[model samples]
Target: MILMSPAEPGRKFIDSPAMTQGHGTVSLKSRNRNSRQLLSSSEDEQYQKERVVSPEIMCSLKSRIANKQNVANVTRNQLSTSHILDASANMTISKEKEERIRRQKEKQEEFRKHLIAKQQNNVSVDNTKNYCDDTALLTRRDLTNTDENSLLTEDSDLLLNTTKPSNNKSVIIVDSREINGAQDIVSTLRFNHDINVVAAQLDSCDYVVSVRMGVDRKQWSEFSNGTNRAKMTERLLEMCDFYERPCLIIEKDKCKPEEKGRILHWTKYVDKTLVHLIQSKMTLFFTENQLETASIVADLCQLENRKNCAISCPINLNTDQQNRVKFYRSIPHLSYVHCLFLCNNYKTVASFLCSDVKTIMTNGKMTEERASNVYNYIRRTFDTQMLPSNYG
Candidate 1:
């Protein structure tokens, strides 16, 4: 207790070992408990701080999430719209293709139907011909030996009987010699009036007739205007109009190779003249085979009321030869008939058919077999009975 050595202010000294140990243990436990409680309090404070957020930061996060969701929605909608447009375009293309195919099928069907109808008509005509042939054997009568001349005379008389006089005193003047072999056609007509046939080359006339046989390339080139054939044609047309003459232009059906074998009008090479004439009907145009030219000329002459004397001719024939004579006589009579049958141009065909059979045969250079074939073909092709009785 004496402060002899005041042991460094209040230093404690253990009196008993058990007491010291119990006190130390208690102090250590208390310190550990205090450290645990402090740690738990700090952790709770940290958790609370982490949980709390600023209002601005919360709004920004929400906006960012909302923007992401909107972007996703927009992208999905664009993809859907693009798919829809693609599908619509494909559908439209498909529809057009289908429509075109359908139209083509329809045209093909129509053509097939037309072919079938044509075939049926041909069959019907054949059946009718057979029926007529069977009936003719029983009712056919014997006929006199009438020559071609007699038949021609009869036809002329028949035509004269039916012709009505016209006030228009139009005369058809011709330059028969100008066209090669065309004189034969004019001579065959045997016009009642004084034929104004001239050997001189004429500039303009009522009728300008020309004939072409086969493909004449040089002649075609000459007419194709190296020297202005179109201008010449125009001038001719104008002259005819001024003179108050009916213009008849006759050309052969044959043309040059360049023309593709089509029987074009003479004025076709003349540019606008053809269209003008057609629209005005100022000129008569004819494109016929060389063989048919005589028939056309004869028809025109007969229509003009030209008088021709009938020639009476009789050929001596036996009972067996009577039919042959009749058949020969029928050839000339069918001139006008065949003309009308072939082209339906009554005047032109009549004039052509009225040509002398001998002249036609010579001009055409046709053999008997070929002529018969042509005649038979025409009779088979057209409804011959539909023609006037006189023509038939």
Candidate 2:
């Protein structure tokens, strides 16, 4: 039997004689080792030629890369500088705008001051004439009634007695500071409205109509002034602390005779202040003139008087009694009047604690509900679980 073997890889097939059963066969053949080495050496030489780079070409490639890098760096620097220049330009423009606005405000304020000064100057002459006329009437009335000795005695009385006689009329306490600005209103209240207008140094408000009512009067110009805005807010808030029914009265602005300018529209600041006052639940009233404002004040005084809320001057209290009043005032929902009543009736916190709810109502003149709340606050047993978790 004749058998043939498979040819090996990377070798040429050649006819060869084999001593296997005296048969001829085809087998793989390989080249001589020296010839293979020569061929490999020649191929390496050609590869080296292809892979190797010339110095000139190398320098050229490096120069091209360097040029690209320089261009990129120049572009980045230009972009950064442009951004910086734009930022500086914007800053300068904003500064210019702010300066222009500040200058405009300054000019407006100066003009307003000048106008106010002019109006005051004009009004001064008229006020002087009116004062002289009032003095003349007073002299005529005083001269007819007494001798020099009696007149001398009554002069001191006249100077001391500035308040008008009430004659069963409602009384209104006017702040001394308001005398200069609201002389016309005061005169109107005294003579026309027949209100007992008493001028006193009131710290909390310009006018007090009742035990729980206060009024702060402001002219349009004063209310709208930027400088007085904070002062007005502070005054109103302080009034709120003192009175249950605090009111703000805005009177019309008085101008010079020839001045034709008027506030046709409110400013944004004015609108914002109005919104804030509304949110605070402040009572606001507007009047066209001094007479109208006086009428409004008179109406408030009469209304409160009808309601039996007439202002009661605080009675003198010793330090102990005063402390008692303070303690009573700390009770929830109790008014100053109710606190005074409690202080006067109970005389001590221990006594107040021992009283029943009905006794509290009788002594403090409080409603049943209010008396019950006080009784519960004083006598209720405290429980550990009833306390807030954060207390622990």
Candidate 3:
């Protein structure tokens, strides 16, 4: 109803709009300002609370971060160490495998050598008159005295019968490799000529005639062929190095009657080779057949016996002794016989080196020329600057 007049600041009214107001009067502008101020103050107080932090809390947080990093580093280190260990283990395993393989190979080699020796013994037993005769030759370890009489293993009768002296029954040492190819020669030497044909493992020759002489038998075809010439030359040259008298027996190829006329004739190459061989100081003998070759061999054996140049008893040298022999063999014009003599006389390389030229000549059974050569060779000065570029 009644429209009341606006109340004055100092007046009081009952049931009026002014009666609902508080004792203090306020402007709308000021009230709005106050509300805005309260909101701003509350926001500032919340932001301060959020920003404030304790030193202990900050340190703990930092420590947690550091601990995580340390843990990561430790894990990385462990992984690296494990990898290294694995690599070392693999290396050790590989080394062990290599060692095992090497031992196996060595065993195999030793076994192979044993088999070869056994086979050689069996063959010698079956072919020779007495097993002990040949075995004694191999078993005699004392090479200090190389007397021919002491070395002879045959029954004294076989060697010293007045009717059939040692000269009449000559001994020829044939290479084991030649057994298959030269069966006829072996048979003829044994049965026909009554010669003691002993098989051995000869490195440089098919037949060892004496301590000084060795023979290599070659067929005419091998001698004439261009392909085989180089190999044959090298072999013959090696033989020359091994023996004082290296002989090559060129046997005519046994062809059928129809093929006899078609046999290859000696070419210029053959003549050239022959000239080269002669120049090398190698002896050559031509034979019509194996029978004739056996006769020639028998004749050679008899001649060597007469000259007291019989073959020495074969001995199985150990590795070191064999190497020593090889070193001795390297000397120019030194024969295998002389090499064996040197080895037999000297127990050690030092003793051999200490010996004078005279002692070397006596012990090695070498001529003055050969002994001088060996002595000079041992004492020869080796100057690297004076050597050719290709020199080994």
lDDT of 1 by residue, 334-353 (tens): 22112212221112333434
For candidate 1, what's the RMSD? 21.0
Model 3 poorest ten-residue lDDT run: 155-164
Q: What is model 2's C-alpha RMSD?
A: 24.2
TM-score of each: 0.26, 0.41, 0.49
* Alpha-carbon runs more than 4 Å astray in model 2: 1-167, 312-392
Among all candidates shown, the one with the greatest TM-score: 3
**Model 2 clash pairs?**
none
List model 2 lDDT by residue over 1-392, tens digit each.
Answer: 84555655322223333343233322221345566888899899889998999999999999999999999999999999999999999999999999999999999999999999998986685456544644554466367644422433333212111111224566777888888978999999999988777776666688988767888888887887778877787788877766678898888787676764655447887889888888885789998889899999999988887775664323346799778978887766565545655765554678677767756764565566778888888776888798788855
Task: List pairs with backbone clashes in candidate 3.
Answer: none
The TM-score obtained by model 2 is 0.41
lDDT of 3 at 290: 98
Model 3 TM-score relative to the real fold: 0.49
lDDT for 301 (candidate 3): 85
True-structure lDDT of candidate 3: 0.74
Q: Considering lDDT, which of the candidate structures 1 and 2 is the better prediction for this target?
A: 2
